[model samples]
Target: MKKITWLLLLVLLTATIHLPAQRKADRKTLENLQAHITYLASDKLEGRRTGSPGEELAAGYIAGQMKQAGLAPKGDNGYLQTFTVWEGRETGEASQLTINDASFAAGEQFVPLPFSAEKPAKGDVLPAVKEPDNIWLIDVQDMELNPHAPATDKYLEKAKEAAENHASGVIFFNGKEDIGAVRQWLREKPAPLSIPAVWVNRDVSRKLDGDNASGFRISMQVAFQQGKRTGTNVIGYIDNGAPNTIILGAHYDHLGYGEDHNSLAKGEKAIHNGADDNASGTAALLELGRMLKNGRFKNNNFILAAFSGEELGLFGSKYFTAHAPVDLERVNFMINMDMVGRLDAAKGLQVGGIGTSPSWTPLLRESAEDMQMHFDSSGVGPSDHTSFYRQQIPVLFLFTGTHADYHKPTDDADKINYDGELSVIKLVYRLIEKANKQDKLMFLPTKETQVSSARFTVTLGIMPDYTYSKGGVRVDGISDGKPAQKAGLAAGDVIMQLGKQPVSNLETYMQALAAFKKGDKTTVTVQRGTQQQTFNIQF
Candidate 1:
């Protein structure tokens, strides 16, 4: 019986195995890239929004492509690395606001701000004063009084001032003439602020400042529901019998129905078909996978990844790094392709994170024959590559620069430059082959991408490296004509202290920034190498 079982197992294994000659790769061509982008950016997918059905559909398509390319599944479940995402929700119908003896209806007399804290809290309704725990009234007349000054700037200034004064909440008084504007704002989603705020109509505002008002208790019940969404990151691998591994990634998600505010074509509601934004990158990734599967590369394994939720703050890539299928220590480097569809033969390509590895420049130069290449040393940028960079892995980000159709409904498949994308794919393929033949690329630390949700009325106009994880926030880039530049602060300066607060990371820096109002002067201490430099900045 044992001999018979062994014989049966051997027969099954032999039957399943295919000869090398029998395994063939499909031809990689411009037509393939065009077809992939056309389907991904089609109107039927509804913009492939993160946490939406459209994104799930895109993920499924990518997994199918990888399977067809003879690539093994490298994800936790087959070819999908599924995860959850929490999104902001609309106000519930039971939510209401009551001030003084009269009860005001929501969406009529008043509406809560987007970033307002949601909780059941009651406090004494005091007049608009420059003190804590008071519902400050900001008249809309004062906000829009100067049309030339810009209403948004003025409102932000006033809000910042009120926040600095420790006002618990703000009640924007929308007069009869400006009620329409308030209504529009109520419909729009606002970023969550440090404090709760609301918009009250003229009738409600009159009651707050009326002579009959005695003691008042302001009550608000705003609740937010925590939701879980399942998203996938299509992952596959090309085994080359090498210890070192290389990662090639692209995101497949985009804004859905213009809800994320990334849409360039505002006002009119339409599908934000992200053909150039990411479908182009994804197509390049697919084509590369097909090319690599042909066994043309010399050494080093390859990881082909199509990530979802990049539009929603790089959630998919971040999740993959945390739960990677392969050992991160063996990774040679990461190459990311994002927005590579609209490459102009004359304009060339903008390659960021070139400074990440010392070998990248020489390798790129050696491979370039008729390509125009521009490079940036900063390893930190807005893309999936940043996730790998944050993990202390060297990365290269390829982009063709932004266009008028970026993040807009007009970003359709028909607008993609197929030949341009094909050229980029070919260049990358050659670079990969070169990299595979060499030793594992050295990983070097570069400036990190500073990202935060904290709001500020004033800025130092300097970009901080959030992934530094050191004692101080390192300045990576400084905007010209900004306060930091005027104060003589330069990149590579580590901010040890902001005003009186010790800066540790991006969050602490934001907290320190909130302490200073516009026009306030403070001393900034920066660690420039072994020396601690101090400069006075006015914000």
Candidate 2:
């Protein structure tokens, strides 16, 4: 009896000691998640803008983390999926026009609109004719100086009408006072046409008012180019001998300069350190990769990808979908992590893409129930998952939601909710485990889908695949918008036909667009829920 009692006591002690260690291990995982967030969100990365050296540095750091996590190279030559982009610039050269004998300099008198294939007018000589429908050349100063100066909207309206009427180009004479402002505006706004638009100083316009001014004419030219600049995507994978793959992605790029609204700072100043914007997401992906690599959960193949150039309009994700390392069809599902570090502790977590796949709701529901996690289940919206959704792949996007500091310089690492992020990571792991145990891949239909963007429009929200050779856009998701809400278009509706045209692709859809202007209505037909439907859209 004494020996048996001693053995029992030993077992009790072991249980007591092991319980705390298990808790400690869980705590350490959470700590590591926070550490990764802090380092990646630091200012040292300089925002990780596309094509910048800072971005390269961030990529290198991420690749190192993946390597340390025991992930194998799933990208070209080790870890980078490279591509190119076209960068644009402006040439500061004055364009002048001579109408009859009247001549104008660049900023002093006129501006040219873009998409003008050639200069519309050239040479000298002509007289004023006030025919109601006849084209007439007039100076900018002449219009501005008039007692009843028309509003800008009115001017554009008249211009559009004039263009429709095939009127000759307008000659704008620059006033000395507003010359600087005019030049600045012209430099920023794309020209309306290649029509012979010219800028002449007040003195020059006055000089041309002399006798024999009939020698007036107009001339102009523009110079530009399209070239390639290199960019890259980092991909890492862990194979668990599963038939289907699970993809986790995040874009590692931010706006390079403070020009657009998405820029982190005001004015043309400050480095856009996109810490919470995405470094947070990328960091989470790294940590998740580490956990999966070390954990005993075995089954589905895991692909972790850090994409470049998302700021320039989801370019990286789009590229990845088009040229995937693995068979895209074999991808069981995709989970996109963007801006996950800044969870609003007060509100808990707001999860999107819950309705994207039938499996998403059930899987997430089970995990949340088991863990008692605080989660809000909204549907998918903008971000990289739209690209995969276009390919008919099921996707779930993870985000903490937008904040006051979003896209601002204040969005630094210090502001992240490390504890909240820990909770989210734990939840994600549970969901992955649940997904891997499923009997078969879930193939959800594209109908009545929900999207956060589009101002809650009840129409089929289909994101077009720009890379598709077919003219019309490849449908990504049909949001629970009007037509889609009523007719039922889900997350994988591919629009192949609209009205009478064979929208065999996106290009054809554009060609069909030329048939209708804003306010004009048309019937749009699309393939969704494995059925064809024609819906009328009033644009």
Candidate 3:
């Protein structure tokens, strides 16, 4: 009897010892994950723009981490999912335009828009004439005028009709306005038309009128060539023998060159350290990938995808979904991390896309309940998940909200809330584990794109918040087919007003946009440049 008691005691003690060691291992795994995040989000990587050396270095580092975690490379020949992209200015070759004997150089005076799909323009210049004759004119009064006004189908129909009637050239007059906005407008893909088009700045317009060069024969040639530059998407996976997979993705690219505000200042223009713009999210994915691999969760196969060209309008994600390595039908869900390192503990974290999947709310709720963490949830908004949502995959997007240091040079590692981020990762780990164990997730769609139950309501066509700005919502890109785009909103156009209400930031904009209905027609005011203009859009 004494020997039997001793055996039972030994078994209990052994079990007790193993339990604490398992807990210790979990904690250690989380710590190592955080350490990885600190390094990736560091300024050393220089923002990891896709196709750049910094981005390559970052990708190599992630592949190494995956290897170390025992996750196999599911990408082409080990780590890269290579593809091609267009490089250089929008115009392919040297382009020149002569107006009334005055010549304008390509890039300096004008260049092709990024969206144009036509061959480069190269031919002899033609004479200019007034309307009712053989010429059509688009008068750009000032920065306040909406250049998209003429790009609409209605305007294109009119322009096409005029072209068929034998119009010579469409001359755009600045009418005392700065040429920057006009230049941006003209740079967009031109609608298919036979008539040639040209734009003149206020100063140039003055020269044309003063010199009486309007009717002078203009002869010029515009040559263009589209270069084929290669790009890549880094992908890694951990298999658990399940047909369904959970994907954690983030764009690993930022605006290259000195174009966007995030670009480094003149002399320092070589690298735009997108620490918060995306290195934060990319770093978070790296850390999470490592944690999941080490923890050895057996719920489902996991896919870690670091996309390229997000700054170029979610191009990477779009490409990945269109040409997926794995079956899209087997992707159970996606949890996307964009800017998770800048959490404000006091305000907690804001999560979107909760309504996209019915299982998300309950799973997140239970995980938070057990972990005792604070977080807020929204049904839907904008992010890469929109890509998968269109494919019928449920998604959840994690964000730390926006701040003043968002896209600026100030969004460095020091500003990151490491402790808050640690909590978020823990919550994510738990959520992933729970999701893997569930039979399947339920699909839920937001009745309205904008959730009206939030503290404030504003409507801005569910554009993804991309600017790394500190406070107010900084939109990186607008949705292609959302209400905002239908209203003529572009990627860089900042929302200053919604309907009659003034929206100083994203919160206010959301509140205002939510007040309207799907079919509601409202006037929206946006700041395109130095001026604000209103447009009537039917929602």
Residue 105, candidate 1: Cα error in Å is: 12
Best by lDDT: 1
Which structure is stronger by TM-score: 1 or 3? 1
lDDT of each: 0.77, 0.63, 0.62
What TM-score does each of the candidates earn?
A: 0.66, 0.67, 0.63
**Candidate 2 vs candidate 3, TM-score winner:** 2
Checking candidate 1 for backbone clashes, the offending pairs are: 115-192, 115-193, 519-539
The best candidate by TM-score is 2
User: What ranking of all candidate models by TM-score puts the best one first?
Assistant: 2, 1, 3
Each candidate structure's count of clashing pairs:
3, 48, 30
Q: After superposition, how far is residue 171 of candidate 3 from its true place, in Å?
A: 10
lDDT of 3 at 534: 73
Candidate 1 per-residue C-alpha lDDT over 373-472 given as tens digits, one digit per residue, 9 for 90 to 100: 9988878777888778877788999999899998788898998888788878878987887887789988777644334344677778776653343457
Residue 102 lDDT in candidate 2: 50
Model 3 Cα displacement at 63 (Å)? 2.7
Runs off by more than 4 Å, candidate 1? 1-28, 86-111, 114-220, 225-230, 447-539
Query: What's the lDDT for residue 1 in model 3?
Result: 100
